[model samples]
Target: MDKKPNHRLAAHMKEAGASNKGLARRVCEVAARHGEQRGTTHVSVQRWLDGGGIQPQTAAFVAEALSDKLHRTITPTDLGFPGPVPVTPTAGVNYAKSLPEALSVLDGLARLRPEDDPPSELLLTEADVDHAALTWLVSRPDGLSNDSAGSRRVGMRDIAAIRTAAGYFMQLDFQFGGGHAHKAFRHYFREEVLPLLDASYSAKVGTALFGAATEISQLLAWTAYDSGNHTLADRYMMSTLRLTQVVDDRMMGARILANMSHQANYLRQASRAMRLARAAIEGGRAHSTPRGMALFAAHEARALSTVGDHTGAGRAMNEAERFFELADTGDDPEWLSYMDEAELVGEFCHCFRDLGKSREAVHFAERAVSLTDPKYARTLGFCRMVLAQSQLLNGELEAAVTTAGLAVEAGDALQSARFQRYVTDFQHAVSVHASNSTVQQFNEQVRDAMTQMDDE
Candidate 1:
């Protein structure tokens, strides 16, 4: 580090209403969010003020934190860093190579729009996901920093507020589906969480803070998936995977891989889905509870079923059930709170339906519907739809139509693109029996529901 007095940085700090400590805190936070834990502190800030040089990447974070504070872009040259400014890409589509770079991509993603040509022009590819997963496995977490900075102390209260709101955001996703569920978390994460990152705290609190951020990112992925914006969801999930390296959260990381598998299955990339599911199972095995293991196994089963691997799918499903049977709710993570017997049964319903086991599909679908809580509005709607599909595929036209009507009415209160897709799929399946009066009535009901959902 060059030990020269940095008048440029000092001048900007004055303009940005930042004290040395405040700037240090922001740098620490910005680095962490991007994927590293840079140990910036008031002392470090004072040293920079004393003309000490920093790494180009660290300089970028300082510039960014100041830019955030001053509400304008600040370059490293402006801060006395004698290096060329990093040319940040227009979006976070590709995996970031460094924390400072990750910060740049995240900033761009937060403000991204259709007008952002480079990123908006780039569609998601399998290479993007494959690279992210491989990077996560190979990445090592940055060493924890005990040093602290910022204007105020950050503690558990701040973390709780973010986590609590995240919990609420998740419930909203479950009840109403993901159409708009991610918005609140986005606002809260940007407004509440980011500011704290700029504040001072122990590394322990920072880890907790980073964990909350990871959760928000993962939730955004799911909500994006729910909205049928699979591309955007992939980007967020890939980002989440990067962050897991920072937090050293193997269990959560594995869960996210399984979610990626779920999305892959939806997109009909069963090959990729199967790979992701196996990766999740392998990675999470050490740290995960039986419930966690069960969840991963269930996802594997679904992917297997999608690829026409009946025996493999059945074997995987059996493992899922076996692990589930050994699960103790007391040992489950908060994220796994939604994965009960009903949820597992729903997975079974889908797999059986895909595997041409209509009898088993209907059986589990009924079990899932019966076991599902009414407040789990979206799950109930999905289970009912699967049940209807199973009935239709089994040549029970009237029963299928009746079940479909129930599904439409049951899901009416929710807005989910996935459910809408399910409705469309069922409609197509029942088209052959269009002459039936019950099928006609169900089609009209579906049209009305679709219209209402679309209008909303």
Candidate 2:
């Protein structure tokens, strides 16, 4: 069968009065601004118009460019691409509406097979984050009727089992890496947790079940992100946010938004990161404990630093410190108990490093490394890598090489892509000093460790 040409894109292009060349040029310009260097041209646009769909990242840039040119929100769906349709002004952002719609989205996502190819369209964007933020700010507690037609009955024991499984998976992620545990977590969710949602229960039990599932979903998102499956991570997070809204758990919703902010900053979408972090603060303001507030503020600080807003970053950092000082763990959720002084300091290290304050970065990184628990091996390795980078920036080559060696040794035990990235970055930084005996030794150690990982 022949693939049909995308009439929707042809019509939109005609309506916008944009030639193929002009559209391609606009897309390239927009993509460059977003830090994506694409060699898109009129030929590419022609192919897409002829029904050869573009990559998801390019589709996002094209949509933004056309939206700007046409003064409308153009989306990949409007171009007849596969995957979820883009939310319009008339349609709510994905997973931000009522319970049934959210559940439907979740069911569809859960049923989807793991594709070797990238998704056909990019559903999540900066605009989606902004809209979600707005929805969270004005969201109310809408009760979900738990009177299911399913025959199986769910009770507190099932919910307890789910919580225990979440905790166990979370520990694996913390001790090793998300890559080691994300698949297991998803498998458990599909096999053990999904049925509970389908089983019969009262409204109270339903709410509890959703809340538990929401936490698991959040963990799944975190693990997906850690393992470098960013689009999948976004989908999991969207489900988690919807579940939190369904349960009226604003604190968890806020944390999810903050997680989105962190991922955006990591991806270099500074504006989007700042917006999401601010939204997180707004969403959690009434219900979050001081510890949770501090965590949100720390995320905001990192986003501000990424955007070159030094003053704003500093203020947010101070706020985080103040909130942390006032925090009582008893008032915080169990999931948030990990956000202590060590975590705050680690965030401070990241903010200062991004801001080019090597001294500050080294100070906080060292503190974080000392304060972090051994159980958090991945975090400890990351902090050590940060410290090594800061040392290099400060012209302490000997200290830098030694600390980097320690970082590599620590990271060798973990399966985290993030840890590997950090090691790679450290290697790149030390390449200029490769002639040094210490640096050469460090490189050899890294190569051996990488080989060991591959062997395992």
Candidate 3:
């Protein structure tokens, strides 16, 4: 209990001409509209002003009743009803309506959103994702400024350093997986990248700064996705999209949308994944390069495959391949340097594997595994697992066991929770052969690999 009288409520009641009994009746009426019933009375109103207790839900109705009477929004706080526990806003989800708001939202992500327990409020919702993507599609680019008040001079060199750090982090993610280097990643982001948001820069430098921030922010989201923190990753991607809008980075904004598509598909929300992918394709059309379009199309194919749409998946995959073939023109962003031929085909491996096209799945998976550079432990790990799945589907149990063992070896060198999931998937697929000793050995290998990696 607050143990303090709510004097503000008395003043608002007079201004709204709400008598105690009349307001009590109105509160009951308001609650009924929302399918809630309340037994409020004039005596309850007096008790409330005398520091007596009230149900939180009933308190809301009282506020709403006054709002209706006064024809103005009336929150409980304005009526001196400050509850003991504060209500924290869900941070890092909104697609900011302006540049300054985006920066503030990003700041709150690290501050207001507690890392412990996560609670139910920290969970991601499909409605939030839909709103973000829709806003990005319709909202005009912001008129950004270089006249931030802090007066700390930001230069091209700082942006270059950030760009370099982003590249390094991407490399680390590709090599050691997302579980590695997050401490260093957040340290650099908080200490180095964030301060630049308020620093002064020339118009050109400001554009470059936001562009560099876009890459780093996307990396932040990607790492979270790989580490299996879907809620956190979704927020990071939302922030990235807002940054892209501020800078009018059509291609980059679309890339963030594609990342959302990938994450949605990963979480088995195939329909929403398809929606995000199409949104990316539509949003990126004006400025995206062949490589960028390839990625968006690949995500579409992935979603289609997951939904059992073989024809649609194949068509989208063809578009991805055609765009990728044209990607040698060098019009892609520095951030997309990773979506090479191998990565494009790796998308095919994922699509075909999901569609149960064993031959094609194996064909693309082996090529992707071989073509992926040795240092890309995560990608290699992914390709090997897909190959194992294809082999298992083709009834090549012995080869499947061998290739899955190889994937487990790669998983040993990676720290991704998603990699661990892939291992689990392969184990489940081969578990039907639980009576077989070789399959059992492979399952044991997977267990050992997961034990060695970051179990978070």
Candidate 4:
């Protein structure tokens, strides 16, 4: 089967579920693994898929990347190319519209999924919500709409406000832990905010408001999930997906699937997780961004690893690597900017840990941990918890306990009940060694710490 560079890479990336930036991130990550310098810029990738050929020498790296990420070997032939390499699709989808219309699309996108048919009405009518505070929420970004408002351009500042607030709430939940703050925020979104927008927003203003609201709502759902409120998390997910439908952002819509995959993994439903992850991959194909593909590949590896399909998972990892290798450093989308080599390695670390490759797990975990910012406390805590588990399995009880302690401490300061639960799971593993005096002591310390944390 012969295919063009774009077609083969594009098809494989669709199966892997990566965004352009995500693909670049993964490539950067794989290159770093081999001690080489690589950049998958959003712009350059877009240029390549737009018909400009990428660097020929970088093709093999793309295959190796997907192989490492997906845990399976893929030939250039698989990507429909000859010789040693294949080009990764770097094309991106950008939605350009007025702020108000963009917002509506973003909100609509949050609610819709590729698997679902289009809904008739993406947003709730004013009759469906209250409008008392809607006017206030829909005010222009800059305090001045009276004079030159006609010529004022809407910029990232508006999006930044939403992102900043979303981040703040996320942090608040993480630090003190998810409880009233999470619930209160959800309530505000559902009652005070949603209703207000429903009742009072104009066409454009309403769309923008809904878009921002949907992003915030998703974060709320994440917080709730972290706090172990799965039912509420599900509700939020539903709402979030609905909002995306109104907002009309396909990439964000795909993200909803990614989050669902995470939820499935938490419940130990590996098959379900893999399905959702694959859906995300397939859905993002229209956009053909590297980041989306990379993300999909990582999730596939995660699901495969969870199901104990080490070989399959490894193959998926390789597929992820291939796409990453072909990533260039230009023409990217903002939604996918957070992805990079560090995050890719972090995903691999999880896969290795689940596959019982303790040494590789520890190595990747350390590398992943070192690459991230301290502000990502919850992620770091997760890495530490996994590392602790690996240590315990290796019979390094003391080291395990100490590492677990650090995870616990990090979790305490962050707002993730989920991370705390992982810590508990590690402790449970420790309890199996009750006959060992050191293990017993370690268990006791864990119990005491948890009890104290709960009480406080």
Candidate 5:
């Protein structure tokens, strides 16, 4: 059967104020910047607008072009495509050999919409991660020569400003969750940081600039992941890893791998998670501080637990603890200063919970809650909810109700969808005991919190 032409593409074309020839020109330009050669013309665009399908690569480029023109995310699906669109391999996954190539991928991702990029394109496979890790393992630092001529000159002040902005965004993300600041951070990176990368700098200044930009890119990825935009998160993480490699920062690369491991586990890609975590350990063994090693091991433990490898998880958890005990806060990277005993205990809570050891889960959850700082509002809420789940599962209904109430209180101050899911999951768990007064009260509190979220 001949398929009908899609009207959505026409509508979006009109919305973007782009004619056939204009859209074709924009797509070719965008594709060329990403190192893809395209021979798209006005006729190709007209065929698309007339309800004929284009090649997957062209479809992706057209979507990017429209997204740029419209200043919002546009997806192939949004254009009424029949199925997942194929993406260029080098779009965000290429491990660039030079700083400029790395920066190009980062800039490309900042402008892309998550839905426009499919999971197959954005998410890393086990083999892909292994190759990346191996590349990092063998790669030497590039000669730090900044001899290129450019219009504007970058300096220490610009680097400091970027670092300061990143720190402020990090604080906001911790307090209110990533959903609150994800868009603003993306805008800041695209509008503020991208321009500086194009400016001239001394080799020393360029190295520092890359370092600062790498950290900010990592933060952007974390916020995007926490905000529930996994596809976007994957793109950002890959870009960050590329930048880390360009700067030859082994510790930062390990952290990025651990993050990829965590995200893989979150998406239920357990075997891939295990591979990535092990890669982090392998790549970081010689260079990382004790605290950094512990972070990587803890991530490995979580991945092991997810796949029901209780013994492996236990060993990894113990290893994480041993390393954490040796950690000196003053000796660690400033980026890793956040990982401590409390964070390790929180990982244990998750590990035990996944292993179905409710009592152990509750014990560590309580300890984590006590040791966690109050400033981490979202983490506190999530930890409390984990405690509540353990309490309920252990048949301590009253305590569960109390603990769940506290989680709701903490969550009320945040705007995170992931946190809301945590609350909602707890609510579902307690609904069987709805007739009890405490359960009833917890339910009411949850209702109130959700209503407040809606109002806000």
Candidate 6:
């Protein structure tokens, strides 16, 4: 009888309280128990989960190993197929009576859509996995695969792959909204890609892996930030900072600081934001590409603007613009290359909005919105939200309400908690005109959005 697919591998590993690496180790140990020396690397196991179907011989070996360790008379039949081969003798009782359930869990995880809300059912905590650490930690179990047929060098092919994937995610994020993209993308990073990197990278490969991990972590942070999960966002930001430093990419280090500054700004710690942003700029001065310098300055200006240092902010903005103008069109560093005219304009819009220069904010925001890709729907949505408030401050209540609705609509598909914060800010701004019919209706819409988002 052909049984269900053997999707329980991940779930079984989880119930066994084994990391992917750990499961590989135990599988090897079991192979050893059977007097067969098998080179079971975590990479091999990961590949298995990545739809690399197991071979029949290896399948029986794994099943037997799992059965013996699980203290049961395990057979291939347990894995959902009627075996032509005889059942192997076991030393003890079934160690994993829950294997079938574990398999079900793994099967479910394999099918989960990243865009949908994470299942409330798993009940796993941060303690269950430090997704940030997976890339660096999960690689080769001591006695695993060693088919290093070529020179042990970090190749351009590998770097290109990482860069390509990162670019794809970043573009998707910009046009569709980070909230729309982060959940699914981050899940792949955490569950699939990271583990593969963990098992295969050499030292140079390790550095590149960390770099990619840091970038992806920052993406997750931004998504969390957009959705209003401040604490989670901060955690991801810190983790990214740690990873960037591990890669020793100074430009990326500076960019990570800028990200931290944004979190600080959102938390209303203007002084901290200023300090972080300044550190980012100063840090970049030592090692940044021209574009990195521009990016750093842009972040610093936003921080300075937040604290009413208009003179300093203006100077920083000018410096940023000058550097941006000098940005080379050649091969660029990973982090700094992502900063372009639209991003710089967006930062300026943020500065003006924070500084209470509503008209200037609106002007820069409109420019940013026009230049930003549709993939950046969330960023544009947030920009529109800021623009609406700026218009309201300029005594354009109807425009503010209309734009606020657009912001809400733009963010409708995102899973981020940050939309609530944006809505809350909009509500606070409109409180002065609560009696006005337009403002009242906008408030009602915002409240409903808040309710729906919160339920998720």
Segments in model 1 whose C-alpha atoms lie over 4 Å from true places? 1-77, 80-90, 112-123
Model 6: runs farther than 4 Å from truth? Answer: 1-159, 175-180, 196-206, 334-338, 447-456
Q: State the local distance difference test value for candidate 5.
A: 0.79
Candidate 3 TM-score, C-alpha based: 0.78
Candidate maximizing lDDT: 3
Candidate 5 residue spans exceeding 4 A from truth:
1-90, 93-98, 112-122, 434-437
Angstrom error of the Cα, residue 449, model 4: value is 2.6
Predicted structure 2: clash tally: 0
Q: Identify the superior model by TM-score, candidate 1 or candidate 5.
A: 1
- Give candidate 4 misplaced runs (Cα > 4 Å): 1-160, 173-177, 199-208, 323-338
Those runs of model 3 whose alpha carbons end farther than 4 Å from true positions after fitting are: 1-89, 111-122, 454-456
- Reference-based lDDT, each prediction: 0.79, 0.80, 0.80, 0.59, 0.79, 0.62
Pairs with backbone N, CA or C atoms under 3 Å apart (clashes), candidate 2: none
Instruction: Report the lDDT tens digits of candidate 2 across residue range 1-456.
Output: 245788988988898899999998998899889865666677777767777534455677888888998898988778775544332222223555655455545544443323321352563766677677787678777666543434357888888888888888888999999878877877777656765665567887888888888888788788877877667677778767877876689999999999999988877889988988999998898889999999999999999998778999999999999999889753776688689899999999999988989999999999999999988888999899999999998899999989989888878968887889888998898899879999999999999999998899
TM-score (all chains, Cα) for each model = 0.83, 0.77, 0.78, 0.61, 0.76, 0.65
After superposition on all C-alphas, the RMSD of every candidate to the true structure, in Å, is 5.9, 15.0, 13.0, 23.0, 11.0, 12.3
Over the stretch 34-108, how does candidate 3's per-residue lDDT look in tens digits?
A: 875665667768767765444445567889999998899998778876432322345666676656556655644
How do the candidates rank by TM-score, highest first? 1, 3, 2, 5, 6, 4
The global Cα lDDT (0 to 1) of model 2 is 0.80
**Model 6: residue 343 alpha-carbon error in angstroms:** 1.7
Better model by lDDT: candidate 2 vs candidate 6: 2
For candidate 2, what is the TM-score?
Answer: 0.77
TM-score of candidate 1 on Cα atoms, chains taken together: 0.83
